[model samples]
Target: MKIEILGTGCAKCKKTKEAIEKVLKQTGVEAEVIKVEDIEKIMSYGVMITPAVVIDGDVKLAGKVPDEKDIRKWIAK
Candidate 1:
C-alpha cells in the first residue's frame, strides 16, 4: 500500500504525518509513506486543504489531522 500525506509543512501537516507514522509503526503495516509539499502536486489530487491523507492514490482524509485509531482503520483497508 502507498500512503501519501499532502501539506505545506505546517504544524497540522506535521502532526498528521506523525500520527500516520505512529500508527504504521504500531500496526507494522509495510507501506510507502510520502509527503507531498509541492502546491501543484497537491492540487493535482484535488485537495484544496493542507494535512490531507491519501491512501493508495485515493483521498481518505482531508483538511485535518486524523487520530491514530482512524489512521489504523484506513491503513487496514
Candidate 2:
C-alpha cells in the first residue's frame, strides 16, 4: 500500500504523518509512506487544503489532522 501525506509542512501536517506512522507500526502494515510538500504536487491530487491524506492515489481526507480511528480505517487493506 502507498500512503501520501500532502501539506506545506505545518504542525498539522507533521502530526498527520506521525499519526499515520504510529498506526502503521502498531498494525504492522507495510506501506510506502511519502510526504508531498510541493504545492504543485499537492494540487495534482486536487487537494486545496493543507494536511491532506491520499491513499493509493485516492484522496481520503483534507483540511485537518485525522484522529487515530480515521487513520486506521484509511490504512486498512
Candidate 3:
C-alpha cells in the first residue's frame, strides 16, 4: 500500500508519520510511506491542511493526526 503523509515537516506531520510507522511495524505490514512536501502535489490532493494521510492515492485523513488505531484500520481497509 502507498501511504503518503502530506506536510511541510511540521510537528504534527512528523507525529503522524511516526504513528503510521509504528502501526506498520506492529502489524508487520509491508507498505510504502512517503512524505509529500511539495506544495503543488499536496494541493492537487485537495488537502488544505497539513498532516494529511493519503492511502493508495485517496485522501483518508487530513488536518490533524489521527489515533494510531484508526490509522491502522484505515490502512487495513
Candidate 4:
C-alpha cells in the first residue's frame, strides 16, 4: 500500500504524517509513506487543502488531521 501525505510542511501536515507513521509502527504495516509538499503536485490530486491523506492514489482524508483509528481503518483497506 502507498500512503501519501500532502501539505506545505505546516504543523497540521507534520502531525498528519506523524499520525500515519505511528499507526504504521504500531500495526507493523509495511507501506510506502510519502510527503507531498509541492503545490502543483498537491493540486493535481484536486486537493485544495493542506494536510490531506491519500491512499493508493485516492484521496481519503482532507483539510484536517485524522485520528489513529480512522487511519488504521483506511490502511487496513
Q: Please tell me which predicted candidate would have the highest lDDT against the true structure.
A: 4
> What is the per-residue lDDT of model 2 for residues 1-77, given as tens digits with 9 covering 90 to 100?
99999999999999999999999999999999999989999999889888999999999999999899998898776
- Measured with C-alpha atoms, the lDDT of residue 45 in candidate 4 is 96
* Residue 21's lDDT in candidate 1: 89
Q: What is the C-alpha lDDT of each candidate?
A: 0.92, 0.93, 0.93, 0.94
| Alpha carbon lDDT at 68, candidate 1 | 85
Clashes of 1: 0
Estimate TM-scores for all models.
Answer: 0.95, 0.96, 0.96, 0.96
- Give per-residue CA lDDT, model 3, range 1-77, as digits (tens): 99999999999999999999999999999999999999999999999998899999989989999798798788784
lDDT of 4 by residue, 13-72 (tens): 999999999999999999999999999999999998889999999999899998999998
Q: How many residue pairs clash in each candidate?
A: 0, 0, 0, 0
The C-alpha stretches of model 3 lying farther than 4 A from their native spots are none
Best by TM-score: 4
**What TM-score, to 2 decimals, does candidate 1 have?**
0.95
Q: For residues 13-44, what per-residue lDDT tens digits would candidate 1 score against the true structure?
A: 99998999888899899989999999999999
lDDT of 4: 0.94
Question: Residue 7 in model 1: shift from native, Å?
Answer: 0.3
lDDT of 4 at 26: 97
